[model samples]
Target chain A: MSDEKKLAIIATKGTLDWGYPPFILASTAAALGYETQVFFTFYGLQLVRKKLDLKVSPLGNPGMPMPMGMDKWFPVLGTALPGMESVMSSMMKKKMRDKGVASLQELRDLCFEAEVKMIACQMTVDLFDFNPADFVDGLEFGGAATFFEFAGESDICLFI
Target chain B: MAAFDQELDATGLNCPLPILRAKKTLSGMEAGQVLRIVATDPGSVKDFEAFSKQTGNELLESGEEAGKFVFLLKKA
Candidate 1:
């Protein structure tokens, strides 16, 4: 076998915050000359859709706790606030930018440039009634078996 | 005059970026050529170790200077 290792990522989360990890890791792995594949399934399909709408989950993400000062006072209300998802998403995006973290779009571009394979789950494609044309150019459409092939051979397998 | 066959300033870049860019740059170079790189990521010491090992490249020299991590690599 060729010495080039492989990385297979199962992307199941659909939120905007969740979107960053898969693309970031995929592109990074690809850049390192590792054969990289990202399998988008279930909610993760939104990431590959033609028109993407991503939002963060301030309601249940304990790791991304509520903003400073307010978390102490309105710990419960923070989760109940209206338009909280968008607010949290924008806030999180700003935080990432401040930390010099590349955006999801940038990471996707890097993945493409790095020759990382983007795979969409066929079951999800059928379930969502999305045509192959609905995704970014050059994406592969396949089922569990295809993903398993990559995952089985990968030195690093991740679920994002 | 170039001190090395190729030089890449990877300062301010973090893990994976340094190694990734290095890999890409090295791919374009002739085999047995040397590459000089500068980075600031503290984890680069270990990252470069794994990278060189996995890719079969030679880490000829590596050290820190002026707060920057310097590395010299010879492609396999």
Candidate 2:
């Protein structure tokens, strides 16, 4: 085995909030000189699409803090109103911008530039009726075996 | 302050942007060349330390100036 450290991550969530961790960690690992690979499966495939449109929903997510002092007094019913998901998503995006957090697209570009391998699960693509052309270029398509080829030998493995 | 071959201003970027940009800068630099970075993110202090250790780069100088964190890193 090569002496270089390797990191493998499985991404399964497509929500805007859940999207950050995999890209952030993988890009950082690659910057650290680790051989990194991120396997996008299930809902995670949404992240690799060329037209990224991930959204966050406050519904059933009690931990999500509402703005305007709503965190302490807001009822769960507030999350069920029409267009609540878009509102929450916009608020989250604004918060990230205010904090100078990198955008998802920027992070993905960094990962690509760093040569971090990105694999899209082929089974999911078929199941979800997604075309390979829909995703960003340079993304590899594979299944469980393909992921294990790299992940099995990796020094660190994470399912995010 | 130590002499540096290049300087990067990362004042408003947060989390991994500063580090990612540093890595990109270091890649284009010759070995042993120093890169001076100025960042405003408080978390970057610890992040740079870890980055130096993990990437085998040298942290020549680490300190604060006028509410910003300054770091000098020597490419390995």
Candidate 2 Cα outliers beyond 4 Å, as residue runs: none
Residue A2 error, candidate 1, Å? 4.9
**All predictions: root-mean-square deviation over Cα?**
2.8, 1.1
DockQ of 1: 0.37
Give the alpha carbon lDDT tens digit for every residue of A1-160 in model 2.
2989999999999999999999999999999989999999999999999999999998898877778887567667877889989988999999999999999999999999999999999999999899999999999999999999999999999999
Each model's TM-score, in the order given? 0.84, 0.97
Candidate 1 CAPRI level = acceptable
Candidate 1 per-residue lDDT over residues A1-160, each given as its tens digit = 4678899999998888789889878876776668999999999988887677778876765666666855677676567688877777888888776654666776677788888998999998898787878788878889999999879988999988
The fnat of each candidate, in order, is 0.20, 0.92
Provide the overall lDDT of each model, using Cα atoms, as 2-decimal numbers: 0.82, 0.94
Candidate 1 stretches greater than 4 Å from native = A1-3, A50-53, A65-67
lDDT of 2 at A36: 97
Shift of residue A98 alpha carbon in model 2, Å: 1.0
lDDT of 1 by residue, B1-76 (tens): 2357899988766655687779889989999999999888788888887878777789898888888889988988
